[model samples]
Target: MPAQPIHTNRLILIPFTLKITKTLMAGDIGILQKLGLQLTPYWPDQEAIDTFPKIIHNLEKVTEPTGFESYMVVHRNSMSVIGDAGFKGLPNDDGEVDIGYAIITQAQKNGYGLEVAKGLASWAFKQPSVKAITARCLLDNKPSARVLEKLGMQQVSTDVELIRWKMMNPAHEQDTIDC
Candidate 1:
């Protein structure tokens, strides 16, 4: 059942749907354009992340990478694509990968981010080849750090704008215990 797909109570982590391309890009210059507009008013606004073209471009990059996989975080009840989350850098000799996620502005504050994060990490651990998952957040982004902590990542370092965290696969419990 590995790679069967992961789900949280409020969201579903599944393969990106082609239909999302239109739904996300409609009514604006592009999807990132719409997302940027939608997120512009929030505190510490991530207008940079909302660039529709970049988001779409990154989504395609994730899909085409032979070493990793990505999923669109769909809100099941609303039947809407609220964000993206995925593991990157897989298949590298390093046995490590970076996990990333960005939930739409309106979706913040609720527990969905933490829930989906944990779900995705758990799913990643289930993969036989995955040894560890990592994530980093801007030092000021307490919310993102909180989600990483909820998923059992230990803070490994901090530098200027970034805080790095790592979660080792459960199979590697002995190493963690020994440390």
Candidate 2:
């Protein structure tokens, strides 16, 4: 079965399909209409546009969304496309998946970032294959760091340019103890 949309209290994360990515990259606004979503003036910004090619390329690898790729972040009340968020891909051999998100300038500082990250982590932990979720933010990106921290992710390491964070699945830890 194809991946289903993940609904949070105030947002619905719709997994990106090849068709949606292609339509967006084609500069077609009809996809929004079809999805029953509103357009935010600040969305489809340069950063979001640039990420489409990558989303498209990744989506092309599978016949359907695996719920491990990118998702369109839509506001529940306004139904507006506020941004994008999701796992980079399936869990690696270590059973860890990396998550990333971007909220439009208009939607920033409203607690949406934490909401999205929390929702993603919650969903990921429920998957048997996902033992941990990892994330990274630029060393200077305090806002992003705050979001990850708020989600209870620990700073696993840091480099000159980025700080890596990780959150292990609590259930997985429990299983280890029970084993």
- Highest TM-score model number: 2
The most accurate candidate by lDDT is 2
Estimate, for each residue in 118-177, the C-alpha lDDT of model 1 and write its tens digit. Answer: 887777777677778889999999999998998899999999999999888888767668
Q: What is the lDDT of residue 120 in candidate 2?
A: 93
lDDT digits (tens) for residues 85-140 of candidate 2:
99888899989999999999988999999999998998999899998999999999
> How many residue-pair clashes does candidate 1 contain?
4
Residue pairs with backbone atoms closer than 3 Å in model 1 (clashes): 31-52, 32-51, 32-52, 33-52
Compared with the true structure, model 2 gives a TM-score of: 0.95
After superposing candidate 2, which stretches have Cα over 4 Å from the reference?
A: 174-179
